[model samples]
Target chain A: MRAAIRSEWTKLWTTRTVWWALLGAFVLMAAAAGQNAIYVENGDVTTASVAVMSVTIAQLAFVALAMLVMTGEYSAGTIRATLSWIPSRGRLLSAKIAVVSAVTLVTGVAVGLLGGVIASAIVDDSGSIAGDAFKIGIYLVLLGALATGLGAALRGPVVTLVVLLMTIVVIPPLLQLPDIAVLNGIADAFPGVAGGHFLYGDADPYPPLVGLLILAGWAALAVAAGWQVLTRRDA
Target chain B: MSITLEKLTKRYGPTLAVDGLDLAVRPGRVTGFLGPNGAGKSTTMRMVLGLDRPTSGRALVGGRAYDSYKWPLREMGALLEAKAVHPGRTGRNHLLAMARSNAVPDRRVDEVLAVVGLTDVARRRSGTHSLGMGQRLGIAGALLADPPVLMLDEPVNGLDPDGVRWIRGLLRDLAAEGRTVFVSSHLLSEMQMTADHLVVIGHGKLLADAPMTEIMGGHATLEDAYYELTGSAA
Candidate 1:
């Protein structure tokens, strides 16, 4: 497993995708934070919502990074070579999960905290910087893992992005419509909604812990299904 | 390590790609695994490397299954296709990642790149290379582990004449070093030059497994013998 992690780490860094994605995430976070600072100036939103908006946009980069984690291998045919070298499918997958999650988590947390600081500097934010920022960071990492799983199962980046974007960005918001109000409960369980509430902290649908668990559950389900397809099918 | 397949079978839904075929590849010689297109050669190789699962039976390298090893590459090296590389990564980085997975040293990546004469272009992205360069990169990765068993599938597909000669000599030399070199090719004459033994399959079933010389003794040439055995020229 140590070897697997080492290999995954090397592969991730050696490829330019990870670096570009990280830059994209940071840039998005900075832009969103700047935009949110404007809202704070006009008292249109609180400092906490600023962190939420920043992460909501910035997390896309992490999701894309995760998508490329497996989709790149599939496209390049490197997964076959990788599996041939490691052979232990479960161990190989575990290492991928660990490395991607760890890297994304650390970076996400730093970006989240920075966004919080930007928001707080404009408005009178209490000490929500540490907690709100940290929680949002965790949500970003979990969302990345979910994207990784979706990438693996779908085996194509465009399709994974399309489906994931529709579910996370489009479907949940559409479900909140007054005409489709019946599905509001189901929509709340979606990653975008659950993660939003989890980051917001005071949302009433579910407790903060429950919200995180709900988001984690979505990640776990995606990765578990991906693992099944990865092991069963020929790479 | 010798490789053995016991009733190895693979089915893609309705198609029985490999139908309970069994064969043993010995060490210290280049064993040519030849078959017509779609005859399950690549599939069998994939199963041997545990990249593909068998429908029934098993493929074992040495005494255990392919995936049973903690570091499979340290036990065996394989080149299934030259197209299995990311376009954005340099050749050296690609091999380094594989080496890390199998606990092979980073220096080995440089060594294999040199061996395959890709030292000059090691820093270049694989996507920019021609097909021949890609083949050399694939061979470099295969040799990164320097394992006992080597399985190369159609490695000569995109090589020039000089490249072909280099690989033919390389295979013989690796075999002379007492390694089990299992090579697959469509070039019958090339196989005749490099392989001491032959394992031919047609439609995923073994048609001939014998010394290369013995198969040719009863025919005009290795190509004629292959055609006779596989019925492509018959």
Candidate 2:
């Protein structure tokens, strides 16, 4: 397991995708945070809110990064070589999840805190930088796990990205637009809504801990589905 | 190490890619796997490497399945296809990752690169490499772990004369060192020069499996013998 993790770490960093994706995430976070600072100036939002909102956009880049970790092997035909080396499908997936989660968590915290500081300075607003940064880190880690699982199950970057974007970015808002109670409840249960609830500390429908658990449940389900396909299907 | 196939079979939907193949490839010789296109050579090798599960029976390396080994690369190295690498990664990095997977020494990556004469381009992204260079990279990857068994599918596909000659010598030397070398190709004449044993299949069924001299009996050349065997099987 340790060897597999080291291999995955090497594989992830050896390519240019990880670096470019992290840079893209940071840039998007800075831009969104700057824009959100304008709302804080008008007393419409808090610095913590700006940080969370900025991460909501920047996390997409991390999603792409995580998905590519799996999809790239399929597209490049390196999966054959990889399986020959590791052989255990479960071990490979676990190693990938570990590496992706670690990288995203560390970088996500950095990006969130940096963006929060910049926004706070711009608006001269006092906010809990550490708390918001921790929240952003956890959210991105779980989201990264979800994307990695989808990538394994889908095995195509474009298809995985489309599915993730639709579910996380597109469908959740549309589901919330209707005033129906069932629809609202379904929307709240979605990973995107759950993530927002957890990050923003919304406690009406569910506590932040429950929100975190909901998102973690989604991640676990996705990873399980991916593992099922990976083990049963031929490379 | 020896590769043992016990009634190994594979079927894709309605198409039978490989049928009930029982053969033993021993060490200390280059065993050429020959067949026309779609004759199941790649499928059979994939099964042995655990890339594709056998529909029935078993394909084992040594006495166990390929995946049963903790470090399969260290047990059996293979070059299934050329350029089976990420385009954005350098060749050295690709080999390094493979080495790390099986806990092979990091220095082995540079050593194999040097062995395959790819030391200069090792740092370049594999996508920019020419066909011949890509083949060399794949061979370097297969040799990274210095395994006892080696399987190569159409290894000479995109090599120039020099590269081809280099590979022939390399295979001979590896086999001379008592490694089981299984190479697949449609070119009978090339195999005639390199292989001591030949395993021929057509339409997913074994047509011939014998020593080179025995299979070449009363034939003008290996190509003529191959045509006669595969032609009748077809």
List, in order, the clash count of every candidate structure.
Answer: 0, 0
In CAPRI terms, where does candidate 2 land? high
Backbone clashes in model 2, listed as residue pairs: none
Off by over 4 Å in 2: A46-48, B232-234
Q: What TM-score would every model get versus the actual structure?
A: 0.96, 0.98
DockQ for each candidate? 0.83, 0.87
DockQ for candidate 1, please give it. 0.83
In candidate 2 chain A, where is summed lDDT lowest over 10 consecutive residues?
Answer: A41-50
**What class would a CAPRI assessor give candidate 1's docking?**
high
Q: What Cα-based lDDT does every candidate model obtain?
A: 0.87, 0.91
Model 2 chain B: worst 10 consecutive residues (lDDT sum): B225-234
